[model samples]
Target: MNEKFTGIVLFIRPHREKDSLVKIFTREFGTKMFFVRGLQSPNHPLKKHLIPLTEHRYWGTINQQGLSFLKEGQTHNLFRSIQSDPFKQAHAAYLSQLVDASIDDNSEDQQLFDIFEAALCSLNEREDARPIQLLLQLKLLRRFGLRLNMNSCVVCGSSQKIEDFSMTHLGVLCHNHLDTDPNRMRLSYKQIKILQLFNEIKLNQLGHVSISDQSYKRIDELIFMIYHEQVGIKLKGESYLNQLYKVADQLKVSKIEGT
Candidate 1:
């Protein structure tokens, strides 16, 4: 049967000498792999659209037992800035990897697709993209039905005087419930507020919110810990992103010292 759908390319792998296996997360079909013959050729028509994070409309033949065959497609948004900028590219790659790891094959999830698209767009356009990336990770976790409760203590349901985040409990712990887990990470009130805001606010409005360096570190660590403990997927793109951030930080320090 032939299927037509709109999707964002999540990954591409070389199938053979000339053919490529393309994995895309589609609005109509959750995640599907297509075998594009001669995609490695310099002149392949669909080559450009096969890039990671590129949104495209695709028409392809579905194989009952194995890989699908791509017939044709047109790119919707190439996100040129994301492809050109190293920071954006790393973040975009990480997002793509996260989506690829989280979703199941051929399972249609329009909400997840929308979130992924919005994340790429935000990263491409926003000057400070880390908050946007962090927000998207939280949304992705929620979409997977693993959302952490920031409103109150998961153990005692107390909202007042929340002081720490318990990875074991997967929520905020009030001062009274702090002893429930000796290993719970202490959190400042401001950090708790930032986590709550991320949960409540929409992705596009993330630009308006300012995150301090400390808050960003706390949130980043929390999100990564949740993914590690709950999701159980190790993403290579994340390591690359960390390296990029380290380099960027070093450059910033050097520039400051030189002035």
Candidate 2:
């Protein structure tokens, strides 16, 4: 007998004989993979509902491999902003990959699902989604038990504030408690607060807050460090971001010289 579910499609792939396999991030069951036979046919019930970020109510059955057979499903929300914008689409893909890679199979995380939904909403509406996404990723990593100690010194736990931060220590190393490590990056108070605030805010309330360029850079650095520490790899989109950063820096330099 097949079980039924309500979920958002996180990823999709073509299967054997024109069928499709979909990885759903569900509301109840965490993440699941389902097979939709004859799904490529235009008349197939689920054909149009197969796109990424498409939320659906699924009627399916669980099999021996934890795979489900899709009997029926209906679209919940066709997010026009996310589906229409190419850059937003790309960002969504990147975020999906990160979540997929970070989480293990058959594990249930309701909190994570909620976080993802909030992230998707933020992506659709926010003007500065990159910084928001970066903040979300950092918070998500911590929620999964990878806490980045941004407050005080990691070595001495002093309240002296973070003077210099590092990807190596995964947080700030206060001046008084600074070890002999020469590979640390310097960070300001503004940067440290932004990283901390990302996890602390309700998703909908993010609109009320704004970040400075310096704080954004710090969050970016912290995000890169978190990815390296937790995922043990670099994000594919990071090089392009780095190039953009270099270009922005050069433009700023040129403007400063002109003034």
Candidate 3:
């Protein structure tokens, strides 16, 4: 019997000469791998719908052992605009890979699916994808139960001014407790406020908030550190993302110099 699923393609790998194995994060079934025969064929109708970050309606059959076989698929949203820009494309790749690595197979989480959908749509529409990326990472971290306690000092439970962030304590450290962890990263009150904003706001409501590049960098550093120390998974796309950002910065500099 065949089952129908609507999901985004997270990752794809070549299987033999003519087939491909795809990892899809579905709203109904969470993450699942599907075997698609003739996916690499020149005339395959589903070829265009198999790209990473593209949403599709997948029709397939699951074997008794629980492997999915793709019968047919139709595109839901190709997000062509995201593919048109190299920077957006790289970020999309990063997001897809991150989600694919972090979430377990057959683990259905509708909230995560919703967040990823909103994030991909937002990235396709927004001029600057960094802020949305940051927001999405924060949301994912929270969803994974690795959330940082920004509400108060984790060490002393003080809601007063936070002076630093401690990976050991898993939250902000007040000035009084700053000495408790020498390895803590110092954070200004403004930075703490920005992080709080990130935690409180929804991905779709990010237009009302603005973040500086310096602030984003700091937050990203902290969040990536948290992922490393807490979650212990290194995102495979980080190096490529760094290269893309460097190239984008150079292009911006060149355009500014020309003007």
Candidate 4:
């Protein structure tokens, strides 16, 4: 009684003794857990083969409790670009944790799986990972039913060019729309345009657009506010990027004020 499927390792944990419990997001069966007997043993196939984020074609079973054992696993590329760079590695780990936290077991969503696969591959191959990260977050939120309106102001439903925008209420609260939330983020037209572009453009096409340093800061704040409201958890990766920008901002201000 066994089932065979292809999956990507999302997370792995050591089990009792030499065993390990591996969590994988599979294309056929969605997220699942498998207990690999003697996974740590030198002779075990998983000992040298299995790793986080590695794609594997596995033969296992869905028992009463959960999936168990590993008959065979063929490992594909380990994404050396992600593994080699510290920043990329950290971002990949963060993305993996987010996906692992959000995706549920025994549910198959091929679209979501494809999006995640595309995102990981893009991050590994892309020269700049920021746009890919942004796109992934947006797509993930949308898949979870938290859709933000990029085409128009959610309050006024105006398709007109938005001059001033806010993210507290999860959309472009236009100039006339009163900000009920005190923490509503006010963004420039350029910031809104970049966000709109990010929503529309493909990862490879993002290189065509140019965003200013000031605009990126505003977009970062808007994304943080929007994602926090939707997910109810502040992303440390966003905070880390914000801190770096904050330091640069302080330096810039110091030079301007000669303090």
Top model by TM-score, which number?
Answer: 1
Error of 1 at 76 (Å): 0.9
Clashing pairs in 4: none
Per residue, candidate 2 scores C-alpha lDDT tens digits across 1-259 of 6667677788778888788888988776777788788887778878777778767777877654667777777877776788887556666766776776667766777887877877887787765667656756766675456777766677888758567766666666877755645777666667666766665666766765677777777667767776777658676656655676678789999999999
Error of 4 at 252 (Å): 13
For each candidate, give its TM-score against the true structure.
Answer: 0.92, 0.81, 0.90, 0.80
Question: Could you report the Cα RMSD, in angstroms, for every candidate shown?
Answer: 1.9, 3.8, 2.1, 4.2
Clashes of each: 0, 2, 0, 0
Ranking by TM-score: 1, 3, 2, 4
Residue 223, candidate 4: alpha-carbon lDDT? 63
Q: Which candidate has the top score in lDDT?
A: 1
lDDT, candidate 1, 176-209, per-residue tens: 8889999987878898888888887888676566
Q: Give the TM-score of candidate 4.
A: 0.80
lDDT (Cα, tens digit) per residue for candidate 4, span 1-259: 5888888787778899988998888888888788888887878766545788767777777653566567787776578788787556666766776676567777887777777777788788876666777766666776567777777777778878565555555666555564554555666777777777778776556563456777765676666666576677675555565565578678899999995
Q: How good is model 1 by TM-score?
A: 0.92
Off by over 4 Å in 1: 143-145, 204-207
Give the higher-TM-score candidate: 2 or 3: 3
- Model 2 CA deviation exceeding 4 Å by range: 64-66, 212-218, 234-259
Candidate 4 lDDT (Cα, whole model)?
A: 0.71
